[model samples]
Each structure stands twice: as structure tokens, then as C-alpha cells.
Target: MSDDRRTTVPVWTLATADVKAPGLPAGESMTGERLAELRGVLAVMADEPIVTLEAHPLPDRIDRGRGIPLDAASPLAQHLSQFITQSARTSLTAARATASGECLYRMVVPAKVAAQLGQGTVRSMVSKAGAGGVLSPLVGPSGKIAAHASYVPVGRAAAVGTVGGAGATAGAAAAGGTALTVAAPLVLMAVAVGVSAYADQQRRQAIEHITELLEQLQEDKLDDERSALNGCRAAIDKATAILLDQGRLGVSLGLDSAVHTIDTALSKVEIRLGRWRSALDGIPEDAAVELATLTKAFPGIDDQGGAFRVHLELAALAVALKRRVVVLQAVEHAQSDPGNPFENFTRQLKRDQQWLDELELGVAAVLVRLSAVKLARPSGLRPVFTPSEVDRLMNAAHRIHQLGVGVTVDGRPTDVAIEIARDKDGSVTVFPALPA
Candidate 1:
């Protein structure tokens, strides 16, 4: 995550399809108009300023030949060309899918462009792109399209800041012919010094903020809470060591262990929450109706007495742990080498903080909903959460789940391709697709 090594960029997969031209049939090359139409469809789907696009043969179909580089005269075409080419080169799954007439059109939009165009506009464009059979027989009835977005890390040159500054300084100096030659080296050196100092200052500020957050978490009283907090601290320390080039190999070994500790803790809480939610869902219809009608506390009512209090505590703890993990990830990204020029680290950090805030609010709202339940003392009653309350709590839990603790469902990261097919009747069906 060192500042000199990786630069993260946002990428969007506008559309991917296994195209079959019913009109052209097998072995018939696509006509110019059809190709243009297909390209236009891809353009609309992307909806963002494209940097490049290229096509590659899917792995099984690589024997068919290399990818075709399309002409980039049009803006969308040019963007598509760059995006497709990058996808083919960078992702094995994407590369493999390119063959056999499967087109995986991906685009990497700079943060600036994403900010300008916005996600709402992009989504609207995608909807418009999919509404009609723009490519007709080439990709209409038989095509499968799926869209996704992800972030990618790219390397940045360590000298980028210095070079950029020096260039500006040189440009200003150029007006004085002889003076320019004499001032060039001094200007370059000055620029380099300024850039290094600024980077160092930014890095220091980020580290200080992360360290301060870690300190607050370390004050937790519970043993499990303390352990999770310690893991976060360790992970951040390891990341810092790696990024700062201090004991990198040794620190790297413990990094995963620290991350795993946090993951294991979060998983346990998730499981408990899931079981609690399931218990609520399993309440009998009669019991739910009775509970809803009860206006006052009744003895022996609420068979799952105290359960609400316990689950709420667990939910609060989960939120706290997740907040730490979020900060840990931000540290990793914010400290990466050379830094991502396209990314606004402060803005991203603020967004993560905001998400964590929303998650806390959601859990709090669930707690407020629980206040309506009238728990009765003693045993033997068949009372449970009211149907409406159950529904509300379930919805809140779902929102919390959607926010996620950054845990991958399968415990490891891997791509799963899905095929989304739209029928002639306008109905759509989606299912997982096996890699070729």
C-alpha cells in the first residue's frame, strides 16, 4: 500500500454479452452497419467518457485469432477501444470471455470524469441502452448482458509530482531564453523538494488521523472488543510498515493474520445476528397476531424475552468492529505508494465515514423499533415479536447486511460471471455462467 507502489482507479463494466447474429448466421462476418450499431450500444451502456477499448478472443476461442482493434474516431468508440483492451489484458476471466464472440466491454473512467457524469446518469444510460434492440440480430434476442463496477490498482511513477511541477516551472522560465537554461536545474530541484515535502506532509497527516482513530478504539472494555481493536491497530501498523519500506517482508507475514482476526470477529457477529433474525422469522402466525394485539405487558408473554436486548448489543458491537475495519482499509488505500492521482483520498475517507455513520443509524433505528414490544415476566407464554416489528427489524438487518463488513462471501476473492438474457417478450432472466 506504499505511496510509491499502487494507484487505485475506478472501473465500470458497462456491458458484456455473448453475441449471436441470427440474421448473419454462423460463419458470416458482421456487416459495417451492424458493427457500428453494436459499438453504439456499448457506448450508450458505458455512459462515461471512455479512455480506450479493445477486443480479445475468449480463452477457449483464442485459437480463432487475436483481438480486433476497432477504429477510435468516435468518442465512445475510442473509450470502448481502450476499456476493452485493458480488460482483455488485465483480467483472465475477461480475456477468456472475449473469444467465441463474447464481448466484455469495460471502461476505466478517471475520478474527475465519474464526478462530472455521476452514477445516476450512468445508470439511466444503462437502462436506456438495454431497453431496445439497438444491435438487432447481431446482439438482440440471443445476447446476454451483465453490468458491474469495481476498483483497480495501477502503478504510478514516483516522479510524477516532481515532473509535473518542474514542467510548469520550466514553461514559465522558457520566456527568458538564456535565463531559462540557467534556471532549469534549479527549478527542477526546487520542484522535486516541494513535491517530496508535500507528499510527506500528506502522508503524515493521514497516519496521524488513523493513529488517533485507533487510539479511541483501544479504550473498549470488553475482552473481545479489545482483541478486535488490537487487530485493527496491528493491521494498520503492518500496512504502514509495508508502505514506508520498513521491515516489509516480516511485516507482510502478520498482515493477513491481523486482517483475519477482524474478519473472524465480524463473521461471528454476523452469524449470531442471522440466527436471531431467523428466530424472529420462525414465530408462529398465531403468536405474532397475539403479540401485535397486546397493548400492555402480560405475564409469561414474549417467549424470547431479553433476546432483543442481546441482539441489539451484538448489532452495536458489529457496527463498532466494522467501523474499525473500514478505517483500516482506508489507511491501506490512503497510504499506497505514489498515491492515486485520480483519487481524492480525503473525499473517499469521508464517504467511508459517512457509510459507517449510516450503518450505526440503521442499527439504532432497529433498537427504537424494539421499544414497542411489551415483554412480560415469567415463562410459558407463546408471545413473540409482532409481525410488523419483525418485518421492520428484518428490513433493518438486510440494510446492515448490504452495507457489509467487507467480507467476501466465499472467504476468498474470485470472479463469477453471470449471464443476463432478455427474452423477446421483454422478460429478463439471469444465471451464473461457467467460464470457457
Candidate 2:
């Protein structure tokens, strides 16, 4: 079995047999089924080497009720004793008295292991014990499945060779067995609460990280592309809504499933955001300015500038849309898992398709300028291609390819040097290209 299906709690405190009724028979025989059930419980409790067991009398000193003293040698007690003897020991803390009149013999067991118990056992055990079962942390409030108290009702056992035992003998023989039972449903509820709290914490941390990344991009000045800015804003809103909605809907019932959902969602968003950051880092403000300069200075370049600018605009837009796609994809996967409530989804897939179109067009334009086309200007009229023009277009194509778009630049590439000067009117002028 997988670790998740194995067990959760590793330690237990076996407590019970607080006060037997006075004047009862010296011994009572348990049903074979009940004996087997108890044995199965003991076997699981002692299955792990790291598990610690502490045996203590429930309600150590009864202050008010008139009851017989515990036998301390009953079948239940013997099973626990033998199990403890065989299992590795851990340092146990001091034992204290339980609530008065509480008759449940409590045994802390693992959740997954506890889940394996039959409903009949859970029901009968609780009905027999006179107390309630509840799950409490093995350590602090760590929202991890640790220890759960399970109560099993047991009757007094008869002493050997005591045919007409006295009241004292009966009381002595019945000392170890108690008729305490606690409700198991309450423990189930407590376990749910702990798991939910842990999932909530994990979700919150991921949300904070995604929000931080979005906010950083929001603060940047991408004035040239207002549409891209607006798209980014929309994406942020969508991502925030996605996470918040998941939180409101609540985590899945199983701890492992809930944790896996949270982790997968977090991973998808982080990966998408990581890719966006990388794409943005490659295109600096100077690259944008160089593209703008090329548009004004290169002949016939301004005609194609609209397409080039749109490509850059889409690149910015993609930085946000890709993240939104990841968010939607993650949410879609969660909702499709037969548990989540998110039913309707309209994914933002158009962004990726549009990005591919823009990247292809931009790269083709750069390659055309580099390999196929030559300047058409007459003598003394200045050449059409400048070093800065080649450098700017080549760099832009490289950036596009780095963003996961394929681009082809065939043949031996030559470097061209071109000086740029700013006129008094704040216009950029490119000088003649130097020899390659």
C-alpha cells in the first residue's frame, strides 16, 4: 500500500477500565467476533516500530462513584501488555485522571489505519464504551493526522478457579475491564477540520507569491502598449479570483488528494509566471527604443512598423495571458477530478495562438532584411540599411526565438557597425553602416 494509504498517527495512549460496577460476576466471556476485533486493533497499534504506547488507568482515582477496583489482568489488558512488550518503547509522559464517570477505554490509532476498521466495529465500540472518541494532535496544532481516541466497550473477565468467588474476588477479577464507549463520528469531524486548515495555509502562501509577481509587473511603465497593460490587469483579476474561489469552495475530503490539488495548482502558476519573467527580462527598454528608431530611419521599414509594434504588444500581452491560461488549466484540472465544484470554464487560449502568429511574422521580416533584401537608394543619397538597423532587427528576432518561437537565419552572418545621433528636435538619425 502507498504511504498515504498506510497510517497517520504513530503513537497511542491505551486508557480504560476506570470503574467496574460493584457486585457484578467475576468473569464474562467475550464473543469471538469482538475478541478478533480487539486483536486486530492491537495488531495495528503495534505494527510500527516507532509507535509509542502508554497504558494507564482511566480516572486514576475515582473521587465520587462507588465502583469495583480494576482487575489489571483482563484479556484486554493482557493484549495491550503483550503488544507493548513486543513493540519498541518511547519515553512516556505522566498519566493523569480522566473526566469523572467517563467509561470509554480510549486507544489512539492512525487515520488511514483507523479508516480500515469496519463500521460495525466503530459503532459497537462506541456504543460499548461510555465516553466519546475525538482526534487530538500528537504534538501541536499542526493540522496533521496524529492521534485519535477510540473507545471500545468491554465487560469484566472471570478469575481462574473461582467458582463461588466472594465480592472482593469478583471486584479484583473485573478490575481491568470497563464498559466505556465514545462516538467515532466526532473524531472524523476533527480530522477534517485539521486537514482543511493545513490546505488553507498552503493555498494562502501560493496566492501571496503570484500576487507579488503580478504587482511587480503592474508597477512597470509599458505606456506604448495600453492594451497589453489592460490585458495584464484582467489576468491578475482572473488569477486572484481563481485562487479565492477554490478556497471558498473548500478542499477535497481526502488529505492526500487535497494536498496534491493544491501543489499541482501552485506548480502550474509558478511555472507560467517563471516563463513570463524570463521573456520580459530578455526585452529591455533599449530594445523597444531601437525598434522605434528603426521604424523611422529605415526605408520601407515604417510600412512594416505597425506589424512589428503589434508583435511587441502581443509579446507583452502574452506575458499576462499565459499566466492566466495556467491558472485556468489548473482550475480545470481540479474541477474535473470528480470532487471540485468549479463547473463552467472559458479558457484564454487565444493569447497563445495570437502570440505564435505575431512571432512568425516578426521573425520572417527580420530574416528577409538580413539575407534577401539590399538597400535601393542611389549614389550620394545614403544607403537604406544601417548597422543599428541590422543589430536591432537581429536582436529582436533572437529575443523572439528565446521566447520559445522558432526562427531561421541562414548563411554566414556579418556584423555591421552603425552610429546613432539625436538631432536637436529629439529625432534619432542613423549614420552609414561600416564594413562587415
* RMSD values, in order shown: 21.2, 26.9
RMSD of candidate 1 to true structure, Å: 21.2
lDDT of 1 by residue, 1-436 (tens): 1123221222222211111111212122343344334434434443222221222211121111111122223222332233334544544544444333344322222233323312111111011346522211112232321111122312111111121211111111112111101111211111112222222222233344434443443323333443453445545444433432212334445656665665565565556445544544454433432343221222112322222333334344444444434433443343343123112323344464454344444444333333333332224355765687776545444433333332222211111122222222222221111110
Error of 2 at 30 (Å): 56
Q: What C-alpha lDDT do the candidate models reach, one value each?
A: 0.31, 0.29
Q: After superposition, how far is residue 232 of candidate 2 from its true place, in Å?
A: 3.2
lDDT leader: 1
Candidate 2's TM-score = 0.22
Residue 82 lDDT (model 1)? 34
Each prediction's TM-score against the native?
0.28, 0.22
**Top TM-score: which candidate number?**
1
